[model samples]
Target: MKNKFIYLIYVILSNLPDFYMIRVWFRNITKLRAKVLKLLPNMEISNGVKIYRGVKISRNSNLILSKGVVIKEFCILGGTIAVGEDTQILSYTKIDGSGKVTIGRDTHIGRENDIFSHYHNISDKNILVNKSKECFQEIHIGNNVMLYSRVAVMGGVNIHDNSAIAYGSIVTKNCEQNFIYAGVPAKKIGERI
Candidate 1:
């Protein structure tokens, strides 16, 4: 019983700030500026780093950004989206979760990427507000994985340790440990470095 109480308190405490932050950000979003006002830059955010207002970041103190990691307009990040040394994230990417989102060193991500951990209940609109109707899953990306622009990654998708995904790809399937993939539903075309 005590453990349950502690767990409940911890969960609420962790999400309270992030939840409110996203709310305030969306409420104050302008036509040009993205809302990252809820995020206090602690570690190095680097030059040319752009964050959208609806980002769901964990503690800023625990997050670190290397040089040249650029997030474009309407890009959502707030979980532990730790860019490794000298990695670059191009425009219009979305990352949301409290689960681990570890980007490898020197990985490059292209534009219009949707990365998330939570799934909304689209079947019924009002049921999504019940808090008990939501389901979440974690996604893990490998070191040196290069995902091109306009990639749509659904839940339960994992790219292995060193793979490259081509542009305009819909990743409904996972690629092998070291391969290159492309197309609407991406598939392993060949092995790559």
Candidate 2:
């Protein structure tokens, strides 16, 4: 019951115009919002966490946001997720954590990135992909990783620490540590210096 009320208040506040004048009047709006969000069930948000306006977090989600984590405007987060300290998820990024998503510290997920931890099982040719049973796989993104704009990460992918994925890449396999990857079904391009 308390979570519902908090979520309602969040919904109302998130709809308010994010103009300078409005912010001036509500100087601590972001902080207030974070406080309310922190009260939700199964959510653990540390200090210095900034969740911008227009970000939609599902009520069913189990989220753990560490210190200095910033989720930019219009991002959608759902399911079970744990984001480490100092990580930033840029605008319009969608993290589907139905199968669990663990993003490490100092990571940057660029704009419009789509990270999913669940995929439809399409082994049966008779059934349509959409109608197929869903398979859950955890996505583990190590510390100091960077996923550029428009990157699409499929389920069961482990992005090792200190790696950088180029813009518009589609990652379907595990990425090595300290490497640079690019292209569809992303392949290693070079080592990160």
Candidate 3:
């Protein structure tokens, strides 16, 4: 009952236009918001964590937002996830963390990006893909990564440190460290020096 009430408060606070406007004028409102978020069950929010208005976090989510993490407006985060310090998730991004998803520090994720940790089982040709059992896979993103706008990271992908993903890329495999990837299936285009 306590958890439900807290979640209700969070939902109400997140939707309030006045609260959102006040946050723009008073930066301290971000801290206040973090305090409220910390009250939710299975949530660990550190100092300087900013969760902007219109961001939806599922009730069952086990989330950890490190210090200086900024989640922009209209972002959807669910399941078990941990974001390192100073990571920024831009507007309209969706992180479906049905499995564990860990993002290292100093990472920048551009707007409208989708990071998914779950997929439907497709081994059975007799059954529809949508109707198949869901499979969960962990996604690990190393430090100082940059993901451009509209990128789609599929399940079981490991993006190494200092990597940059170009816009509109679909990541279906592992990304090596210090590399730039782009394309429909996200191939290595260049290496970071």
TM-score of each: 0.60, 0.94, 0.94
lDDT of each residue in 12-107, candidate 1, tens digit only = 432332333565643333211211322344434544343433333334324556554444444556655566655666656776654546666667
- Write model 3 residue lDDT over 68-106, tens digit each, in one string: 999888899999999999999999999999988999999
lDDT of each: 0.59, 0.91, 0.91
Worst 10-residue lDDT window, candidate 1 = 30-39
lDDT at residue 51 of model 1 (Cα atoms): 42
State how far residue 158 of model 2 sits from its true place (Å): 0.3
Selected candidate, larger lDDT, 1 vs 2: 2
Write the residue-wise lDDT of candidate 2 on 1-193 in tens digits: 8878899998887766556577564446655667788988688999988777888999889999999998888999999999999999999999999999999999999999999999888999999887999999999999999999999999999999999999999999999999999999899999988
RMSD of each: 10.6, 1.6, 1.7
> Which residue ranges in model 1 land beyond 4 Å of their true spot?
1-62, 66-68, 72-74, 121-132
Candidate 2 TM-score to native: 0.94
Q: Number of clashing residue pairs in every model?
A: 3, 0, 0
